[model samples]
Target: MFKRLLLTLAFSSSIIWFGSCAQKSQTTADQIEKAKEQHAAVVEQTQQQQKLLEEKTRKLQEENQQLQAQLQRLQEEKRELEKQKAQIAKIQKFQNVKAENLQSAQCEINPDLGVPLNPPQAKPGECFAIGYLPAKYKYEKVKVLVDAGGEKVITTPPKYKVVPKKILVREESKKIVVIPPVYKTVTEKVLVRPATTKKVVVRPAKYKWVTEKVLVEPAKKVWKRGRSFLTHAVATRFDPNTGDILCLVEVPPKYKYIKKKVMVEPPVVKEVPVPPVYKTITKKVLVKPAQTKEVVIPAVYKTVYVKELVEPAKVQKIKIPPKYDYVTKRVKVRDEQFLWVKVLCKDNMTKDAIIKLQKALKSKGYYRGPIDGIYGPLTQEAVVNFQKDNDIPITPGAVTLKTLQLLGIK
Candidate 1:
């Protein structure tokens, strides 16, 4: 519908413009024809009248120039109007594309209700537009099953009482016992010592002195700053004095040989064996051999009791109840959407409203034009861009209610 309206208005404007242009062109032609006839008539008069005719002719030419300028301006204005239409068409196409995409968008879901969140339709006097609807939540305490019912097993141990009873452990028998041998002490004389050979060195060790060189210092290259011998001034390696130079020189280490004593030959020794030594000592001598004896033995007994099963294990069924609990869950109550909204246009727009709109857009970094209370091209461009960025209905050159609400304006 809007596109058709635009086309109709454009056609009407073109017809009117062309008609006005044709009328003006005809009038100018007629005026030029009349002026030519008057020039001919003036040429037939005196020379003085001819001067007046020339002046009039020049004036008429000036008027023609002015008319031509006006026509050029009209043409330029028509071009501008066409450009504006193109821009409007582009914006409309963009909006149509966006609407197509939005059609496929799924509605927001309410978690708690398990349904899509849909707001009530706008009333006649109210404006509805898409807006962020935060999720609502509530805390609740609910019962939840923690454990299920099951069977349990229980057992009782058997009873027991202790009583004494005699039992033979060993049988009676006659046994023979052995006695240890006895011994008598006696003194005897024996050899106390024998001859032994000792290890004897055949030759003594020999020693000699040898000379060896030991390193006293290592060789290295060192940097040395140049010094002024006359003034005894040594220049620093860094930030040196003028004409001073540093040199890296190699210095050889000095060493000296030293004499040390060392063994030249090892000593030799010989070993010799000798007879074993003996000594006189007092010792015991056996006087009797081992003997045995017989004796009577008694049997052994112990007390014990037998075990028996008294009761068997059994299972018990227990009915465990279910536990329950409640938790807070967020659920959407309403979702944002697009609807008919009142906007600031020529009908309701005012200087104050425009100024406020410009100020708001400026604050949101969308506008850079002066806040002169005029919805000029720059202001309109700002509004259209803002609407596009914010997903508001793209009302080019107009400020919608949703735009104002988002900008924090009442």
Candidate 2:
């Protein structure tokens, strides 16, 4: 029995110890499961944090790209501004500048990346747009002249737009040498039209006057010879002379006048073609003169002939075609004399004296145009004609000192 109890106790002790160890092992397992859950939670949290950091990095990269683009645009704008600065100074001198015209503002190139540090602006502080305001410039000057004697006038300037205006024009004149007046002859062809002329004439017409002789049956009349058994002699008298001519040899005026016949011709009638006739009926209307006043507009031309400077300059080979000169009109512009006059042409003789020359003979209706210090046909003819008609020496075309006295020229 004692042996049995010991064995039983040992078994019981073994059971207690085993039960305790089993409880301890279960606790340890629980601790291990908790630790594993903790480790898993840490790993998950680390992955979530890493994902967030990667998103932030990607956003930062996008922002950096935007910034780089903005920097590039800014650099371009700066270059443009510097280029236009010089031209702006020159233009400023001609036009007034407003305070607002120079307003500057920074432009933000990208809006999606973040709130713009600077906004895109037309009137930016950094630069001006050459497209809106021209970088290159040009200058011109105009003259405003006032009359020395005139009403004092106030002037108000007008504003101008950028549209180009045509250049002003002016004209210049110069004196030129020309020939003088002289009588000349020319041949011309003439055409003549026949004119109608009317005339009338009277002529004798065919007619007859007859006188009849009386036969023996004639009535008796007392005669110097008394009644004769035969016929009495008929007498005819001449119209101017009353002398009678015996006409038994040819029966005389005692005979009776017989019927006379005359032949007639029909009057000539000709048909004529007449021109169309027009008639005028008066009506009230405004009448204009045959000639109208002419407005003499002065000739206009340019003075400045500026040539453009071209890039990659090239010389243009302009082939000018040959041209011809034309004479628009022939006018007596000048008349002069440089020779001595004949003595008999005017008065006393001299060696070197200016006679009644064309250029200087205005008092006697001679001379034409400027005296260009020469003698020509027009001057010589005037002197010759004056001498010939005035009963002076009729020298052909020579001027001697003697002719100078009468002309009052020395």
Number of the predicted model whose lDDT against the real structure is largest? 1
lDDT measured at residue 175 in model 2 versus the true structure, 0 to 100: 29
lDDT of 1 by residue, 139-216 (tens): 344343333324433232233333334677578865543333456778776654467776778988889999989888
Model 1, residue 197: distance off in Å is 58
TM-score of each: 0.24, 0.23
Please, what are the lDDT tens digits per residue for candidate 2 over residues 1-410?
A: 99667555655664576468557644654454456556557657866786787688658855765665556556655765665575445334312322123122115222442323332352322322110112222333322221122232222222222222235554543322121112234444332223433433344455565555444345443323312233554543333453433232322334554555545553344445434323232222324322212334345532222223233423333333332222122222322111111222222222222333543454676655345434455565565556544544333334534444567766
**lDDT to native, each model:** 0.57, 0.40
Candidate 2 segments whose C-alpha is farther than 4 A from its true place: 93-410
Q: Which ten residues in a row have the lowest lDDT in candidate 1?
A: 128-137
Worst 10 residues of 2 by lDDT: 128-137
